[model samples]
Target: MAINEKSPSPAPAIVESEPATRCGSNTPGLAATSSNNGEKPIAHASLEERAGALAVPPPSGTTSSRYRWLVHVQFFACCWAMVVAGWNDGSTGPLLPRIQEVYGVNYTIVSLVWVFACVGFLTGAIANMFLEPRFGFGKTIFIGACFQFVGYAIESAALPFPAFVLGYAINGVGMALQDAQANGYVSNLPNSSTKMSFLHAAYGLGALASPLAATQFAQLPHWSFHFLISFGVALLDAIILAAVFRFKTHDECLAAIGQVRHLDEPSEKNDDSGSETEKSHFRKVMTLKETHLMAVFILVYVGVEVTVGGWTVTYVINERNGGPSSGYISTGFFGGLTLGRMGLIWANNKIGERKALVIYAALAIGLELVVWLVHSLVGDAIAVSFVGFFLGPMYPIAMNVCGRIIPPSLLTGSIGWIAGLGQAGSALFPFITGAISNKAGIESLQPIVVAMMAFTIGLWICVPRDKVRTASPSSSSPEGAGAIPPPPRPVVNV
Candidate 1:
């Protein structure tokens, strides 16, 4: 593989100096001058050439102190959306019995709500596969909020079960799109793994808030009121999201995060050279093998996480004799999850993301075993909370790892595919649980949870440990100069 380097200082306009490889010249490396300024001459490269450069590992000790604050802000923006979605989605578990009582349906039929939501997610994930490139991250999120608002609005009307399902399905579509794109965008930035932990913590916040929210909403006498409140929140989120869209960046999002010194390009004596150079530099991302592996891992992991959250409420209600108030059990679980993410911020700072994931996975399986053995409601509550705590970092950590393992160019699509796979799993498992509970007995749910956790443990073994290398701006640059490494490998699936 060969790399084409261009000088930072502008050169005199000329017919040609030397012919660069057909596709090899387009990439503006980390050292390349601002694309906005004509000071740095741009070069074009073929996809293969760009991929080759992307494949080169970053040197260790590279950090993004400059962009740290901006990363956190963007992360929080994504987190706010997750919190809203989690509140809407996780609340279903606690509200199921009420819905069943009001609608006069069986438990199996009631669980179908999750099926509708999962199906919608699947649709959104698939849609994101194409939409992400066209809309960019900001617009994709706003669109997702719109879908969620519509879904919530539809559900608020208290229509028949079929109508409810349709509405939930619509919401899922928006969530799936926002999730894939937001996650893809997040995975590409510096310190992404840590940022991911912080970002997912917001989901825990929403999840924790949900049962409480439902408990309060239940006091309102009409479920429609609950949906109305949710609708208002979703509308607000959409507005905030749309305003956030104005920050999109080219070349790198570095400017958005305040990492760059200037936005304006040096006044170029005009030529079509730079624009042509950048367009050619755009590269194809995923190889067939990488794509397949990503799909498998994500499918398995999401099934485990969602299944646990979705069923924990049911298990408490059916097996432990918990009432609507027992919905607090779900809160305990998300409480653990929230705490775990906070703890991970400290843990990751000490040992880095890879080691943190290894520890989190082993502990999660152990907690699941506790849930398996303990038959009492108290025991179930403890086990579920522990499960939440341990599983907290998996999604973000896995995403961080994926970003590192794959080239940046393929990031948006790769993240979308992984998210889609997870949504597919989500769609499959809740439906399976509904069907299984109808026949094998609700107790079978315990074994299903155990099995999913075990499968995740096994999958962890196949994931290659991330290797860190020290990166230099260039051979001539002295040590200690600032440099940002590529994204880390994904450790846990969503």
Candidate 2:
């Protein structure tokens, strides 16, 4: 519970100083600097006494307001990747029937694409733990974009069902990799919750547009043309992402994002024992109860969102007897989602994230009940859209909480799994809904979603009541492997 404070000003070379605790490298405490400039501080050591000298501070100069504005632009570019994710996510529900007919498979088989995609997401999420440490944030996202390109290209080829599943699976991997990076990047910044809300709002906008565009594209002779649109968007997303987060390493990437700045740090830099250090951090963070809780939280939350969106069209057309015109109701759902994120972002600040989630979720549950019970097409559509609206801010808010509790040393890995495998819910729950629908009928989607929502609430309540941790300068940077941790809590699991 004690904190060590070091003066910012350089100190004379010392033989000894007060000892610091062991295994608290990432905890925010003053790091005493020995005057020796050459040697770096010893990491992962117990009883820190005059640990090696930190690099001398370079000449300090203010970043121009103009430069700050330019950096803000990069934030928008990052949102584009989210938009692409939303587009791909939104398109799936509308395209399921078409894919089923074209592949000559049952709903159960066609839905397997979701499972494959979840597999890809889980793999990509794990891969990012190593990727970000070595390649830095920018390049990790680039690798993800590349996966999207590969996935879309393969799907666009109109190959057999297996190949099509493979393409979408790749796309899922790409989405999780980029997702983890972006959320980790943004979550640590100032006003992160508000910014995260807008960032996710871009996804809403993309999702809102997808069903309309995809439905039109599906009407074409080649239904696969929908993937082509996704492909083009991914290409643009990759270019923008590279330009925005283009750092040679995570250190530079952090500086670029205004997390840490070095007056004298050179353009090129090397991380000390980065590979081994990354592995160590990964294992260290895996021990946290919060990490696992948040992951399950994401799984349930995303599962509910994707299930409702992904199955809405099918449910409307087949179950409600609403016909093709009813397909556009997915747009209404996404529209409410878009509006909720945009409208409630600042409102969440007023009411607090936890309170807001509770209220919105209750309202969403109520509306979902309406959708389930009310057989009227117009009433169900209205209820469903409201359901989406209330669900909109849950993800960004939950992620903001994760950003608060997770240690900086393990931010990438923890967020990766939470964002990555959590997305598995998208595939997993939808697949479940489809399987159940095959037997119980598509009407099962409403009950399935309601049940999932109930489960989500339980898992959500299990997330540690997050208190925002103050980030010290060293801790703010992704390269701050030795930054201090947030407030410690007794280990408790849901």
Candidate 3:
């Protein structure tokens, strides 16, 4: 096999000097370009193009059977770790009231946990650029494990308010690191939509279990003891990852999974080649229209999910006059979320991704409004659960769509930022809601959620469609690489 960049007219790389656009004008679903005669469907043309592109491929050796076993190990172990992270995510909101009671703090002060967690996650996401390039995948994940273990150890010690918040921040960084890596890695696999859905479902499953356990454990004299369970699980996950992936490096792992073909490895003497490769990837990733649109969409989606999870119990008990027994309703919301991710994988695929997203977003918005407008606690609880159910499939679906649109060369870094910074929703929106509640009342979660849902629908409309255009007659049998798709169109419907 041979490798060469010989497309007749390649799309120019986005220059570093230009800022990336915030949205694109392409149609809602797949990006497409009609055939010259306008007789063929864009999807069909895209598959043909992909086929031709695959025909003149770069050299790559087949993975041995050992690689297969390790791949399974890596996948299951990463999933185990994600489950622990999910447990942390779900338990927090339920335990927040207890923490506030223990520390004698108000809503505004208690919200700092989300803020600190946000900071930690963002820090870790940015740190990936330096960490993966130097330490590679296995060692880098090991570092994250250390951070989680140490952070959990601190939290389990039952420290002061500030100290406990600090522990959360540290653990946030660790979890973000792992989360970003796992999502990116999963997106490149062959059955990505299914895999991503299942991966996140595991997260949801763990999330479902967390609130149930936390509500039980949080009642006694020690609220923080609930975290000890999470700590033990995290420790076990760390050991699994370390044992399975000890020697694998960044390039090694991607190659093992077939994502390494898009970017070539530079020879030892040409250090500049590596730098140039990185720059080119950075250019495509930042410049892609889908990258920005998906980022903002996720920002809103995550904020909606975490905000509801984090503040629902507070809202139910305080604003709706529900009791501690009702606080466990947060798990119902999370249970819907888990089931949605698990159950909706087929529906999402059946309808195109864009339509599926729009449908779910609309459903979530309406249900959330019911939770807001209605005064009954039981009614609100049911609405919140349904809202979570609709909102469940959003994250993994968004990530899967993103992987399809962005060039393969930029997958890891591009996804790293998307998963990391997009997660700021986990902090920013919730913090804003908490602050507003401090002033106006906890009733504010309703409008914030409604507005976010509206924003989500509009943003999905602006996402670039995935399609392929026909080549001119002269280049009918292209010599080398397939042509790159055109740059993202202008913002259309948004």
Candidate 4:
């Protein structure tokens, strides 16, 4: 007998007032009665009732309304930490002359501070990969703050040359940890682009203000006293971090915020499996071509930024033949950088990040050229400020892109590596410039900056575009097949 070919009838839909499985217990026959049969349909259980039924806890990404205030406080603390980092970085440029005079060293020797800082940054990046998983975000950030406090304390006393360099290494570790965590946290939040811009703008504010303080200190006998100010800020950062975080682990913090992952069904895996998963994730992050491309792009970008900020005063004094007021050029550069980050959010959104960055780089290169070719001190200073303005938004924009491209699972580690390694450019390129300047004169600073800016444009082109997946109409339903839900966008109006 020939059988007719037909698809099987679809299964009847069942409406459950409460889940059949709760806390490993099976409680069947909870489906709502049919209203067509003259029976009342059952109401759905509330979230509290559902939680009580399921004894298992939710994952870190779940949202809890009660702990939302902590998120805002933590964000402010992160901004304050960035300010401290900027102060440390910005002070170096103005204080370079005084440091050289105090230690009786050349440009090459003075540049060792950058080298040591680079070492510290790399070390911190590596350490964060290991430390964050074990100690969690709160402790890691707090430890980093403590390291900065130590570094600043040592530097404030103006110790022997080797000890002074060691302070920078310590500071590097602190900054790297805080930088990685803060960026990772902010990038995941709602309106991340705007938030990232504001965060970096805080850094620019510190950078802008530092030169003003450092210039005056450079003329004083106790020039090293400038670090005392940094030391105080670092201490404040540590206290705020400790109090706000309450030494909570990463998972604990997530749970407190009701942002638990796998809210309905908890995983039964042990620590060993978790470690293995992390290892695999790390392997995946390292192998991706985007990670390396971003690392290099950031390295070159930071190199150009720090090189200009750190060397501009010296260049103005020696190359442009300016006097005590030359240090103000550094202030102008950071001021422009701050303004760009604050004011250019609209432009960044209008033109798109990739194209906007290309434009910004081109403009920056033209400004660098003007600074190089124009002999007028006033014109060079103004051009340098504009250069800062163009370069200012690049860091945050690149960071936002990095967040989008990289998997959320591997975000913290990947950012740690990228940010840590990228910061190396701040040290490596400046040191290279200083070593070269020892023989070639500070005039070479312009060529070096222009070359790096050109190179940044090329590297940025190689970065992968972020993948944007549109949800189908069916996928919008909770029960849709092959549906992947987007994360909640919780606005922290701080």
What lDDT tens digits, residue by residue, belong to model 2 across residues 363-429? Answer: 8989998988888889999998999899999988888787677654455568888899777888898
**Winning model by lDDT:** 4
Query: TM-score: which candidate is best?
Result: 2
Task: Report the poorest 10 consecutive residues by lDDT, candidate 3.
Answer: 16-25
True-structure Cα RMSD, model 3: 11.1
Query: What CA RMSD would you report for each candidate?
Result: 10.0, 8.2, 11.1, 10.6
Quantify all predictions' global Cα lDDT against the true fold.
Answer: 0.62, 0.72, 0.69, 0.74
Candidate numbers, best lDDT first, in rank order: 4, 2, 3, 1
User: Candidate 3 lDDT, tens digit per residue, 6-27?
Assistant: 3333443221111111111011
Question: What TM-score does structure 1 among the candidates reach?
Answer: 0.76
Tens digit of per-residue lDDT, candidate 1, span 142-221: 88899999988998998998998888899888878777767765654455567677777887888788777776565456
- Summed backbone clashes in each candidate are 31, 8, 6, 14
TM-score of each: 0.76, 0.83, 0.78, 0.81
Off by over 4 Å in 4: 1-69, 254-278, 468-494
Which of 2 and 4 is ahead in lDDT?
4
Candidate 3 colliding pairs: 30-465, 30-466, 31-465, 31-466, 31-467, 32-467
